[model samples]
Every structure is written in C-alpha cells, then in structure tokens.
Target: MGGRLPMSGMEGFLAGLAHPVIGPDHLLFVLAIGALASTQAGGVWLPVVFVLTGLGGTLLHLAEMNLPLLEIFVSVSLVLAGWLLARRQTPGLAVLLGLGAIAGIFHGYAYAESIIGAESSPLGGYLVGLATIQLGIAVAVCQWCQFLRLSKAGVTEANGSGRSVENLLRYAGFTFFGAGLAFLSGALPSL
Candidate 1:
C-alpha cells in the first residue's frame, strides 16, 4: 500500500480528499482547529503548521523512518482536542498553535503513508491538493464559527451564548473521542 503513490493530478487530489475523510481522527482534527481558530488568537496559523509539519512527516515516511507510535499519537491528540472543545476551553494562542503543530506531525505522517513512492510532479500536486483542501475546510469552518460569534444568533460567550455551535462542537468532540476509541480498539479501519 505504501508503494502505490498516485502519478497524476486528479489521482493526487482524490487521494488527498480520501486521506482526511476516511480517517475520523483527521476530520475531527480539522474541525477542532476551525472552531478554535474563530474563537482564539493565531487560529489562522494552526492549519499552516498542520500542513507544513504534516508534509515534514510525509518526507520522513519517504525516507523510511517511521515514528513507531504515530497512530496512537493521532488518537491521543483527537481525544484531547475533543475534551477541550467539549469543555469550551479557549486556550491561549501559543498553546493552541503548539498543540496544532504537534497534531500536524501525526497527520502529515499518515498522509505520507499513501504517497510513499510518488514522483516529484505528483508529489507536488499531492501536497498542494492536500494542503489546499484541509486549509479550505479549516477556513470555511472558521468563518462559520465567526459568523455565529458575531451574528445576533442570540448567543454570547457567557451564559450559554453560541449554544448551537457549542453543541455542535460538543457533539464533534464526543464523536472524535468515540472514533479514537474505536480506532484504538481496532473496530474502525483507517489508512
């Protein structure tokens, strides 16, 4: 599986989309970052670090040096993010950025597994497509969070304001935790 990297632009993009969507942890990670970005400072940099550090991981995979516990790390990060979101904890900017960057490494490593032997051209496209989609998802979610924050949706940070978004986040957090648990127990499958 690791040796069958895509060789075309379309293939690369499809693989990019598949990698994140098929992995519940990956999608939850994006959701966590997006929700955090709108409510926290330097949220904008979270996706950047995720994509870049992930690419670094992909490079490591290509070099044949895998971090032994990458999957466990991914699941752990997902659970922690879910906890933070479930509790409505808005962390400091530095903490958010740092945690997001660390998460990125796990994600990038996973992404790399699919593109192990990709040629330079396809690899470039694969990286761009993956980064672009994930970034776009994060930004779009961030905007949604921002709108909920600013709109007269009859919500406020205090007194259960943003209840809908909060509930969604809570649901997402729970879902992430469940998925992580499932992944850990080998119930659900991942690439």
Candidate 2:
C-alpha cells in the first residue's frame, strides 16, 4: 500500500500536499513553528525560510546527496520545536532563523523520499505543492493567533472556551513535546 509513486504531476501535487498533514511529527513541528512565529513581528517569514530550505533539501536528495541519520535529525528537530513552544521563550531572530533553516532541510529530505522515482514534472509539482500547503498552514496559524490577540504580553482572553488562546497554545506546545518524545523513541530503534 505504500511503495507506489505518484504517476503524474497532479498526482504528485496531491501527494505532496498530503504528506506533511499525514505525518504526525511533521504536522506538530510545523504547527509549533507557525504558533511561535505568530508572536514575533516578522514571524511570517520564518515559514518562508523553512519552505525554501525544504526545497533545497529535496533537490539535494534528488542529486543523491546523503544526510546520515536523516530520520533522527527530523525527530530531534521536532523535539527542539516542541521545546521552543513549551517554554514560550522569545528566541533572538538569528537563533530562530538558524533553527528553522536546519530543521527545514531535514524535514525536506524526508519529504523527498516519497518522490524518489518521479519525473521532473511530478517533482516540480511536488515542490510547489509542498510549499503551498506548508505556507498555507503556517499563515493560517499566524493569522489565527493574531486574530485572537495571542501575544507574549499575556493580554489574551478566553475564546468562549474556558481557556485563553495563550493557554491553549501552551497546551499545544506540551502536546507537541510529548509527541516529539514518542516519535524520538520510535526513531531511535531504527538507528
């Protein structure tokens, strides 16, 4: 059920769009990045950095470049992302950008695995699809945070549910942290 490659550009696009959403680790990490970025002034660009690096990672894989312990790196990135969210720390822009770039490569590498045998058209479509969905998710999360006034200053309030948006985001962070640990444990055995 899993070895089949996308047969056309459209198929590749669909597959690429679905890949991040389907992978729990990837989904959580992306969500964390989006939520974290929402707190900063220029946070919207964080996802752009990730998407660009991710594309490069995919191209590197296509060029036969090897990144040892790819899965481990991906899992570790998730752990770091979770930590960033859970702590609610406002990391320096440089530090955050650096982390996003590194993590993007690893995640992108994993993404390329699914399109190894595809032709150029499908590959292009895949890249476009990946970029579109990821950016969409990040922007959506950023907008949501903005709409709810989820800032670092603790000026947010309950959104009709008993908990404030900031509190809910923190909970999301904790969830990502737990999920990352679980993913790391599962990834370690494969090494």
- Residue 187, model 2: lDDT of 86
The worst-scoring run of ten residues by lDDT in candidate 1 lies at 182-191
1-191, model 1: which lDDT tens digit per residue? 24477878777877776678677678878877787776675577777777778788877787888677778788787777777777777688788788888888877888787787777777777887788878988888888877776675526445654566667666777777677776665623543
Q: Work out candidate 1's RMSD over C-alphas.
A: 4.0
TM-score of each: 0.84, 0.91
Clashing pairs in 2: none
Number of the top TM-score candidate: 2
- Over 84-123, each residue of candidate 2 has an lDDT whose tens digit, in order, gives 7777775876788889999999999899999998988888
- Residue 160 lDDT, candidate 1, scale 0-100: 53
Give the CA lDDT, 0 to 100, for residue 186 in model 2. 88
Q: For model 1, what is the alpha-carbon lDDT of residue 120?
A: 75
Highest lDDT, which number?
2
Error of 1 at 170 (Å): 3.4
